[model samples]
Target: MSSSEVHLRSTIGGVSVEGQLHTLSVWFILALRLMMGLAFLQAGLSKLLGGEFNAAGYLANQPASNGSPLADLFVAMSEMPLFMEFVNVAVPWGQLCIGLGLLVGCLTRLAAFWGAFMMVLFYFGNWDVAHGYINGDFAYMLVFLSVAAFGAGRILGLDATIEQYDVGGQPLVERYPWTRYLLG
Candidate 1:
């Protein structure tokens, strides 16, 4: 272990994991970022490339159940003609943009934030109450949040390139602290 490592002993469902935080974090963050990136990319491509893709049908049929608190919101969204039109375009494009950003590890923090937002909408605003259980959306959302928190792009991503200073001795991130947050 390196001097930076913090030893940890933890268990999940009776399985024990003993390791150093600094050592594990690097691998975990990179894998998590890459996986989440691939997943978003696949989903975005499927939606964008799919024929006659529309959010209306999915939004319109939200089980409309009293058990589902978000059902009303879904209904309200569906009822708005302009909103539906916007959603039809926005969902696909937003997914595509977020996916591409994450995949290349460009604008990593922004990509992670948006990815988490979408998963929140999917897990809480659409799927949770009706489904009666947490699902992959929750897991994926956590992964995205982890990437942002760990600044995973610095591990092996374009963000690493953007992080270094230029000949002017000013990194782009010097112009925007937020870029440092993304590249970290």
Candidate 2:
């Protein structure tokens, strides 16, 4: 790390960059959020609408490799038909909510966090067990964290609107001080 890095001021699409990477990062966050959000939304909706959707089959079909580290998860989840059924219903809905939230910039941080959690679960249960080479999940996780870290919701998002919302004739923050944590 040297203090030699110098950012020459530049402009793109008529917007000033001020030699700061933050300007570029804003666009990247939006793109990444949409990518992750839409993927989850479509996947969730497909499962719910597809009459033949079943988690058991998917879980049970995991190829056994190196003692099958994911076998326990598959077995435990499959054994309980009732729980499986619950999961079948819950997972899709959760995905849909997370996708919509991230897509709309509503509760963006929470949505990103949940999306990261789901990615983590899939990474462990699927890629780790299969010894897969694809590392898209890692990329997705990083993007989610980045968006959350930068408070992206305030940029062209409902979070900005929600933050200024008035409750009982007072701004949300003034009415409920604790809402500062939840608004954006």
Candidate 3:
């Protein structure tokens, strides 16, 4: 590669070049990241502010006799009031951290992975509400999973710069194989 080409590649994440705008997929990924981050931020702030964020009450109100897998889990968890309190506090903070990480494009892959896990918890928690599909929770989960799979961070985030380094080009990344998808 020419010297100029090497410089360009090295600076990709540092600054946006005039003709090197991100692709449509990158833009879509950015939008999804922002939306998911905002959603989690709002939920976390509401909980922190004591704005009727009552998971226990909501779980208790669920129909225990309905034989829903989620409901059963909820009932079991509700039995431990202390555990519920911990969850109430932890859930909000976890969302806040994950949301902020995604928003700032810091640790994008890790954030997406955690976001997906959270979505799974949400999906199971609300399984009875939508019959296991066609819900915001499921949609969010899928989106996060996609981001994790694609490593969308490299498209326009700090990961793009990070990847230029030797560590980012390590065999682990090559073996994982998904990192290449993020290069776009």
Model 2 lowest lDDT segment of ten: 60-69
RMSD of each: 5.5, 7.9, 9.5
Model 2 bad stretches (over 4 Å): 1-20, 63-68, 128-134, 168-170, 173-183
Worst window of 10 by summed lDDT in candidate 3: 1-10
lDDT of 3: 0.69
**How far is 81's C-alpha from truth in model 2 (Å)?**
2.1
Against the reference, the lDDT scores of all candidates come to: 0.77, 0.72, 0.69
Off by over 4 Å in 3: 1-22, 51-53, 63-67, 128-132, 162-184
Where does model 1 exceed 4 Å of error?
A: 4-20, 63-66, 125-133, 165-168
Q: What's each prediction's TM-score?
A: 0.81, 0.74, 0.68
- Tell how far residue 106 is off in model 2, in angstroms: 0.7
Using TM-score as the measure, the top candidate is 1
Give the best candidate by lDDT. Answer: 1
User: Model 2, residue 66: displacement in angstroms?
Assistant: 7.2
Candidate 3 lDDT score at position 74: 80
Q: Order candidates by lDDT, high to low.
A: 1, 2, 3
